[model samples]
Target: MLAHSFMSDEKKQNSPRPLILAVEDHDDNLVLMSYALESLGCRFICQKDSTNTVLVAKEYQPDLILLDILLPTISGIDVVRYLQQDALTCNIPVVAVTALASREDKERILKAGFNAYLSKPYMIEELETVIRRLLCGKIDSTSGFELCKE
Candidate 1:
């Protein structure tokens, strides 16, 4: 085996690398999510605190948001609602990526106004697909942008 093997550089890859917002309190979860996003080769903004999601979202202007239901100071539901109400950030998609695994709970979250709802411990492919669709504006309906060509 060669001692000095040159690894393929990640930055050189052509993935769009959107500014995805990952709002999760768990450090491990955040890291895990980062790993998944990294595989897709996308950059991200993380908000470990629930209270600061809007502020961070506004500042970062992420393409999509992955919110956890159980958060401090504020709930993910409120954050989703807030984003939906804001004109500047309203067009962005807010997807619930939580551990709350109940059809009733999902329905409730959907009713509260989320662009999409996904469960925690989800497959990386699912997360990627979901985020891709949302960010690409495939969901449409008062949202912004279309699927990126490049």
Candidate 2:
């Protein structure tokens, strides 16, 4: 199977893609989430947990961040707070890609300063729409995002 790989390992060696910092803990969820992102024509750097989230964000300087609520070292709330507080990284928009997407969860994360939230088991179009809206400033709200129109 390895020898018959479609791309021929050689081509796979130099795929140049922009990096996005994805902070997720659960392995299965991470795979699913990544699949959706890739399906939407997005590329990223995956961080297993919150421990290296900051360092990676700083170093990698990804186009956007996808964070989980629960992490190993620090909480996702704290991660948002930290990014919002620091002037250098303050402009970066963070989205809560987590299972905690209840009303309170949404309210708290927004209050804590996340640009958006995408509940688990989400669709590719949803991620694409949210990211496009955020990047283009089409959705006008206090968080700099407009609510989805009905």
Candidate 3:
């Protein structure tokens, strides 16, 4: 289902839902994320290949992005860097979702330009919390959420 076309024009103008760009190579992961985003009343564009992630993101103009750190050919960190450099997509928040759970790995991903990080096998609630925190533009140190430096 293409969630982007699901919303009507009136609904968009009245109460628009946040659009998400989910870049993950795993089909199962894409399905799971799609379900989660749908359940949360958010629209999403999913890309299984990282090769064209930046292009797709620019076209979709998502409010946020859920990026996987490990992808075929291109790493998620590189994708993040590309997005950060592109004026069209630079402002969109990107959260890394990957299996790299080590402290150093997390730090490295953050340093690469991701706005937030979510380790693999993350809880649905945790994902929801992170998504909400980012979409709301509430990146406070006291809010128990870690945000990347500008």
Candidate 4:
């Protein structure tokens, strides 16, 4: 339940950056994600487990959520269900960051309410791409993302 914030110096000097909520049970994974999110100029809160995730999400109302599927107390899929049921945090985009890399796993996770999926062992570039798209992209009539008009 350790929460920390990071921002790139340039982003700090400019407009406010996106705030992200990352839920991961592993300390090492949390550290790695913190660095990656920092490099992307995002302010993030990291939760070590899913026990208080719904409360935390409601409190913060971050722009996006990075959730690990296999979490302690409550699984990430279940967490998404809880988040979707709550109006305060329902619209925030959720990305599944998990080791489950199979096609079936990806399909299932997306069907479970995650807006995006990123397999574990992902590169920083991939993480950056996901963050950028979800934060900057626009939701279309079909409930899918599209490049925002400039």
TM-score of each: 0.77, 0.73, 0.81, 0.81
What pairs collide in candidate 3?
none
C-alpha positional error of residue 1 in candidate 1 after TM-score superposition, expressed in Å: 52
Candidate 2 structure quality by residue, lDDT tens digits, 1-150: 011101112221333433346778787866765665554444666666576667667765666788888876789999988887776678888988877868998898888989999888787568767776765642222321222322
TM-score of 1: 0.77
Candidate 1, pairs of clashing residues: none
Query: How does each model score on lDDT?
Result: 0.72, 0.66, 0.79, 0.79
Candidate 2 residues lying further than 4 Å off, grouped into runs, are: 1-18, 137-150
Model 1, 42: alpha-carbon shift in Å?
0.9
Cα RMSD, model 3: 7.6
All candidates: CA RMSD (Å): 10.2, 8.8, 7.6, 7.0
Best by lDDT: 4
- Residue range 45-69, candidate 3, lDDT tens digits: 7777788778777877788999999
In candidate 4, what are the lDDT values of residues 1-150, reduced to their tens digit?
444333334332324667788888787888888887765656778787788788888876788999999976789999999999999989999999999999999999999999999999888668777887898842122211222222
Model 1 agreement with the true structure over 1-150: per-residue lDDT tens digits: 111111123322444456678888888888777776656656666667777677667766777788888886689999888888888788888889899989999999989888888898887668777876876643323212212322
* Clashes per model (N, Cα, C within 3 A): 0, 4, 0, 0
Ranking by lDDT: 4, 3, 1, 2
Error of 2 at 113 (Å): 0.3
